[model samples]
Target: MILKTIFLGLEAGGKSIVIMNGDDAERLGVLSLGRVAIRFNGEEKTAIVHKSSKLADPGTIGVCKRVWSDLGLSEGAEVVVEAASFPDSLYFIRNKLAGRKLGSDEMREIVEDTVAEKLSDVELSAFVTALHSFGLDLDEATYLSLAMIETGRTMKLDGGPIVDKHSIGGVPGDKTTLLVVPLVAAAGLLIPKSSSRAITSPAGTADRAEVLMPVTLDLDEMRGVVERTGGAVVWGGAVHLAPADDIFVKVEYPLSIDPLLLPSIMSKKRAVGADLLVVDIPTGRGAKVKTIGEADLLAKDFMEIGSRLGITVRCAVTYGEEPIGSAIGPALEAREALEALMNMGTAPDLVDKATAIAGMILEMAGRSDGKVLAEELLRSGRAVEKMREIIAAQGGDPDITPDDIVVGEERLTIESGRPGHVLWINNSSVAEVAKAAGCPKDRGAGILLHKKIGEVVGEGEPLFTIVAERTSNLRRAQERLEKARILAVGDRMEMLIHEVKERPVVKRSFNLDR
Candidate 1:
């Protein structure tokens, strides 16, 4: 049926969509959420259909930005609309939903369609949920990784040993990347680090780094920075490496599931031509991997996948019972990282963790006393210098200092009620509080701890401070604190953790990060 085009001037998050009146939809033999083939000027495109009685007229079809641009449709242009069948990928997705493992061809087809925007959000959500429920075997995971790598852009850098590091993030305030990149690069190795923004956490590495430098660099610009300074910290979204993962992440965010974790990390590493890689698995209570055994199993999977993708892999099972440093938001973490790199302040745990990870990358690249060398790089002010160079290369201020970084002015300090030694810190609750304070979005909003696990605390002494750009956000965080116990302090361990007077509703915290 020939219909006039009405440009909607809006996007469906990269999906092609069209709206039509109920009468027009009935005449064309299509229903809402159905598919339609639109043809204009000898070009054809398929878009998901939405039916509206009043928004669209009987003789006109409303086109979204993506479809309108693809078809070169103008306002009141003539176009042909016909009912269309869904792609075969939907069938494969159905099979997965039925607890069937897909072959390599099926996986590749699904990934290709996903990149081509042939699958709608509902279809993609089904696929992601199926993987989460049924899970993927090693072979299936490998197939997905290769398919994603093939379907996305790749980088080929000329270097002897291109090293990279990743953390299966669960701990908050992890600005280790800010230190690791400069440390390893100062030791003469190529480290092109691409990180994600906050998914289910208060802050991600990219979010924190973005407080210091521009992270949204394209692939070419990323290469230029890496080539000049031997290191770079850019956002993965702009690079288009395994672009399908970006879409998958969007689906996984609301679902709180990440079945694609293996392929997601390995695919990006393969795309960047990383020869040696270290995956940090924060293990302990309050971390993703709650036990050392679980961490070891995860490490094995990572190593196996790296072997399949021709990248060497090692895992660092680090302590994750508490936040990495005193800071737990983007700006606060960035400032802490810079201070650590400059060796100006005493963040013993943060410095130790960063140097150890950087040392692993060094040792993987054939260096002796890797930890000592990494320490020297920081102590001698070389890592900070390298970081300055990287910042300048990425179009940020080279002379940026900790004090130069501004934080939120609205703040609240919680103090200890009783004197005791710090017993434990709840990572999830900490993240929740920071998120309530408008973290990541409000770069200056965050939390700073005055004490950590095993530290001494005095009655009425400061426990932690919450900072926010707005008083409303600070109040929101304070409200979250009333319901959540972020840390514990006591003279002795309490035998009774809690009392269950009746049937209790348990809410599990789900963390999804890359």
Candidate 2:
């Protein structure tokens, strides 16, 4: 069918097409080649017929044709379009991409096609935005989750009750995963965890874990490691689990949209075949869940979704007003996590959070005796031993110690200005300092807090230390600390502005009809 249209602009790569007047484009479907009739302002204009290949290349057109064919659209169907209508067309495309009652094979196709970079960033963004806006129903989320799982490599363990934990993230310095996995595994639970690298922060779980041992593991190696040592900490990026989630994350991270966050979390857990899951939801200023109420709602949602997915989900709403551990960078966090697990050093907050989380996992696995069991496993060297076994199994040095983990060459110390109690610590500011120090990149670059909130410090006492590989980074981090009002030395903490702003009302007119 012939359609009238105007060519808008070119997309990054080909995939450009003339826009028609109506939504019949979906009905006409995508054409490898089509005719366009342009009409301006209700007046018939000249036809601007062009080949679809002119918009993109032959390869892109072929892919589009294949995708359209998969959608069961017919060729030569009349399509009404306009260049300005691309945005709306995106929505239609996304809905189709989400698919209704999709099978495992179809889901696999989506993931493979997506990873091949067949979809442009804009198209990917549209699909993600549509899922976020319309919300993925349980069935759809399950399908999508399963699809993502199968698209990438799958690690199979020859056992049940494989224990694992995950944090929904969006909080910097919540390095509980690094600590919890080792702690649980040390307790003799089969815990094979896959973590992500940093997206916005300077350090992610994978980054931090890499500080101690290698995190990049193939699927076979991962399964072998888990089988041999009963646990392994590795990077998820290396092995795809819920790959679509990764694509969506590229969009969600920048926009901070998490409408389907709970599903995403549970789906990953389900995909990994974690029978028991402990989800840490940090709630406070600068965290994903900003309030206790919101955190509770999310916790409930996660538990319910997990149940539906045949997994047990337990959530903890931890304090996130500040960094959980003294370390913030990948290497620094890894060093600290190892130290804590090995019982060689102590970061009370980190230790407490880890023990609490590990305890919960142990409880779910029916080995609960609170921190007693957790501390015993850690202090008796069982956890450390397990960690060593896992590390060695994963191709890392089992004898690696905290001292073995190197730090940046350049370092700077932050001193207390006044002799008073540390009232508050701003997590976001701390993350900024760590980022400036090059935590994830430098591995050794990060901030180590010597004092925490409620701790009394003398004037000129060392408050924190910034480590970096370069002098410039040290100075940059120091400069950031100079301007950062992260710590408050007073009796009371400053309150945040949490009130919502009111919008002005607009008058409306209506008539009653008989």
Candidate 3:
């Protein structure tokens, strides 16, 4: 159909969309949502079709601004329209939905279509849902990982033994990357770490790092920064690595990033040229991989995939029953990380966890007594200097001290309901409270713990502190936790009765924790 173009001046996601006249639709035997091929100014692309007599006059097509820009046409331009041919990957997606494994080439085609915007959100969601519903087999997962790596940009580091770590994030207040990277890098290793923002928790490695230094560096800039400082922490999204995984991530974990985590990790590490990788899988109640068996299987999968992709991998299962550090937000965690590196923070868990991971990296690099070397670096202040150098390289203030970190102005202190021994701290509840208080986005938003498991507190004594940019968020978080006992203050017998929720949501036994 020949029609006049009416630019619609809007974004229709990545798909090109055009509206057809009702009369023209009837003449062409088309429906309201048919596919069409739009052509103007020597350019043609497939577009989804909509019909409206009011929006466009007869014999005139309405185009979104994206289509107009693609055609290099202004309003009232002329174009030709025809039925569009659908891509073949949709059939493979349907096959997967029917419990069929996709071949490597088929998966590659689907991922390429995703990156090229040839697939709509609905179509892409179908792919993600299929993968989620019938989780990919190891072969399929490995192929999917390779396809993702092939389609996106990759980082090239000049040095051998590019060491990296993946904190399989589940526990709240687990911000040790800030300390471990500095610790490992101080010992003459190239550790270029790329992290993501928070998903289900208050903060992620990248989010917390952003509180101190810029995490969004382009590939070239990231390379330069690492070259200068021997290590750096940045966001993986900036480098265009495994971009198809990012799309699946958007569908599965809207504000999170855990769907198809196996591929996500392997592909990202492979893209960055990491030779040795340590995967931190925190296992316990209220955390992912709650059992040693599950963690072992996951670790084996990591090793298998790493072998398939030619990378050496290790998995560290750490305690995740409670928050790792004293703080649980961007700014607060950044400060706490620096304090831990400075050997001034009282968070023994944070210090122990950081040293443990750094020690693993040191051991991977053939160092003697990895834990001791890691501690020596942290205590000797060389890690602090390395951190300063990294901060400066990433466009942040090198001399910025922990005192300079600005946390939420509005705050509330949670006190113990009754005086007794602290039995446990629910990781999920604390993470939820902090997220409600406005995290990741609000740099100053977070939570601070005063008492942990096995500690004692008096009635009305401080248990934890909630900080937020707005008083409303702080109050909301407080209400959520008012009836929730994240920090139980009673004996094991009493603890069995008290739970994380107000009322009994589950018949949970304290046997595992005990």
Q: Which one is best on lDDT? A: 1
Worst 10 residues of 1 by lDDT: 8-17
Candidate 2 lDDT over 330-413, as tens digits, reads 777877878887786667788888888899889988874857788778788777788788778877788888888888888788
For model 3, residues 103-162, the per-residue Cα lDDT tens digits are 999999998877765676677777888887888888998998899899998888887789
Tell me how far the alpha carbon of residue 345 in candidate 1 is from the true structure, in angstroms, after superposition. 2.7
**lDDT of prediction 2:** 0.67
State the weakest 10-residue window (summed lDDT) of model 3: 505-514
What C-alpha lDDT do the candidate models reach, one value each? 0.94, 0.67, 0.83
Worst 10 residues of 2 by lDDT: 505-514
Q: Model 2: runs farther than 4 Å from truth?
A: 1-118, 134-140, 494-514
Assess every candidate by TM-score.
0.98, 0.76, 0.90
Q: How many angstroms is residue 20 displaced in model 3 relative to the true structure, after the best TM-score fit?
A: 5.6
lDDT of 1: 0.94
